[model samples]
Target: MEIFNHNANINFLGMRKFSVGIAILLMIASIALIAVKGLNYGLDFTGGVSLVVDFEQPVQIGEVRDALEKGGMEHAIVQSLGGTREVSIRLQPKDDPASGVANGGKVNLDRIAEDVTRTLQAARPDARLKSRDYVGSAVGEELRSDGIIAAIVVVLGIGLYLGIRFEWRFAVAAIATEAHDALVTVGIFALMQREFDLTVLASVLAVIGYSINDKVVVFDRVRELFRLARKAEPEEILNRSINNTLSRTIITALFTAITMAALYFFGGPVVHGFAITMLIGILIGTLSSIFVASPILLWLGVSKQDLMPKTKDNPELARRP
Candidate 1:
């Protein structure tokens, strides 16, 4: 089946110059916001208490906060989970130097949680602690480092794989697209001050993987079109490639957005944030594959003649000289 027949042709090539300007402006703004406001890193990266509590009746967040305060646990973060029946609480560590550390100056989060739980039980008999987790500062630092390493590895792996399968240009294009998606996603998190946590890290990785999949699809098609239209200018060939795969790209993006929207609305608190981030990434990834990444490749002077070695001395006959 011919994918180009739908005329999903957006004439994006015509507006390519303007798209670059817009992307540059956005990138600058994103960088400035990141530097100024910073991300809202959660307890998963910084030491804090996380407790999941179940109650016999529907829970009210205000009442929980009040109860904790009454028990001398003021300034605790409390939010209802799933609905109003399950709730999670995070308590900030005490500022006192010795409150958290035990022997050898290691954080004793379990002890802190134990004390807090006992205090809460005495204040609110209805609150039943279902589960608890604590991340010490040392442990959180390790996890943060590991997450960064994983993201780097993923980007490099994609570059290497695509380079081997296609060409260095294609590989670079794919990795650039991945970085484009990640920076935009991270910029949004920083701008909005969303909690950066383990779940957020997972979503970032997922977005990287998803963005590359879309980019590689477009790059593969571009490579094919380069071969088919050996005489065409790079811009014309890229436009043709994008036009050809435009239908598939839009359909895939729409379907993914629909699924993610459902999860955002009904997937529960456990995954709601992750789903929202993925949804945003999907839209950005699709747009970047078409506008940002492809335009960069064109600007870089990619041509069909580069990928395929010369077979005939009269190859000039097949292309404009």
Candidate 2:
């Protein structure tokens, strides 16, 4: 069950600057890409009409898309749920009263639904409208705001947890890698202009959880080595800690990657985006745990004294002992 029988002497800490530099460059590029290209926010973040249409027979998604295009709904979002004949479509209303609500009357939600039904009628005559819904722009905005707040809360919570469990230096290092993992993942989405939806947001949260767990494992080992090898330098302890956990890390990552690969290829388009983000998150999470977080301790001047806080002896308690 052991891949590395002897303790590894790999100089992981020696290359801290190189790895940290690369991470910084990648993060900078990612921020630039996101600023310029931006993410493709899906209907979840933008107001739109949604229709759950079920066809008489199994129809190819391509045919459904073509019908939408020909019906003057080229900008419509059509997603097939699995390989079945069910497909959901979300599109902005043609005559949106929200644009001039102050001067106009109430929004005709039913009217928009009728128009979508009519548009798809020509191509699939036997199609049945199972459900109809509308998401207002205001509602989408609220959801977006809430998502951002939730993410911030998660990051702050992680920092607090690490600080209490370990030391301030360890806390900062963990947070740095956590931020790096998130930004890099978001950057990939922005670079590809992939539709950023609620599920994708969920994936981001999942990534944070996975990344933190991995970092804690390595950090815990580092702390353990600090106690055991009192004479060992910080650099040597870091290398030993990472190398000792190398086999476990690799094996765990490999198994998880295999599962994610299967989900990405076979999970269908609805969950495809989620799987892709998860895969990216897993890879980045592993890298950051090893390179980004642990190396930061070295830069922060973490010594054996910091790891083991000096215990102050109370005069009264000492007299009793």
Candidate 3:
């Protein structure tokens, strides 16, 4: 079941410039929105209250959320726990404790909890509070810093690994591709004002790994073609490589999308952010491998010699001169 035929002759490289242009415009828009609107950091990065409650009966998650909004906790994260009557809610800190630090003063946690409980009781008369946890501003700051560090480390590790396995040009191209996927994903979150939490952060890391896998598939094909298409121009060789692997790329992305779509629909609200990030990343990463990464190779002037350095006085180089 190949999405593209074995004998396909799609000139993927020929469309690189147009694709890159579109990516550039997207990057610019994403950056601007990020600067202006910024991300909606969740309780994971901002001090907040985590509440678990048990209701006497199964209730609509939507009405519970609406009650929270009416109670002045706008955009609160609420989800049913394990298909049961239990629900967990994270109420964003009311006093700007985004730094996760107590800062010498605090809101009365008990009062806040009472107010939230009463609000939900209006929706479901039998709401019973099970437990409440207060995350300080300091904790949010640490989590936020750690999440940023993790993302940087993953990107650098990929660059180093690719550099050692392939060439620096390919490594750089891979890094650029990762950046393209990451930025677009982040931009979407900012533009939509979605909550950025631990789960969403994990999704970002997952997207980085997934994007690399797609790039490696194309890079592997390019290296194989370099040895056989020795007389072909870089663009022609790249076009051949991408066309050959196009089927595999599409199939992989298609199946992955199916899985994520199911999660988005059935996995409940708790995993919604995670599913959305992955869906966008997979699509961006697949296209970036062909348009963004391959075009970078062309700019770097990568040749057969770069792929196979063991052979001295390469025939391709000899023929070039």
Clashes of 3: 6
RMSD of 2: 4.3
**Global local distance difference test of model 3:** 0.85
Off by over 4 Å in 3: 54-74, 79-87, 93-105, 121-127, 309-321
Residue 195 lDDT in candidate 3: 86
lDDT of 3 by residue, 219-261 (tens): 8888888977748578888888888888898899999999999
Error of 3 at 18 (Å): 2.6
Tens digits of lDDT, candidate 1, 151-191: 98999999999888777877777777787788788889998
Reference-based TM-score of each model: 0.76, 0.82, 0.84
Ranking by TM-score: 3, 2, 1
Compared with the true structure, the alpha-carbon lDDT of candidate 2 equals 0.82
Residue range 1-321, candidate 2, lDDT tens digits: 557643978888888899999999989988998899988887788777888888889887768778888977776777887857899888765654542233445556677667667777888887778899877878888888998788778988998999998888888998888888989999999999988988898899889998888888888888888988859688888888888887777777778888888988886556777888888999998988778787898889777777774444556655664
Query: Candidate 1 vs candidate 2: which has greater TM-score?
Result: 2
Error of 2 at 194 (Å): 1.1
Instruction: Point to the candidate with the largest TM-score.
Output: 3
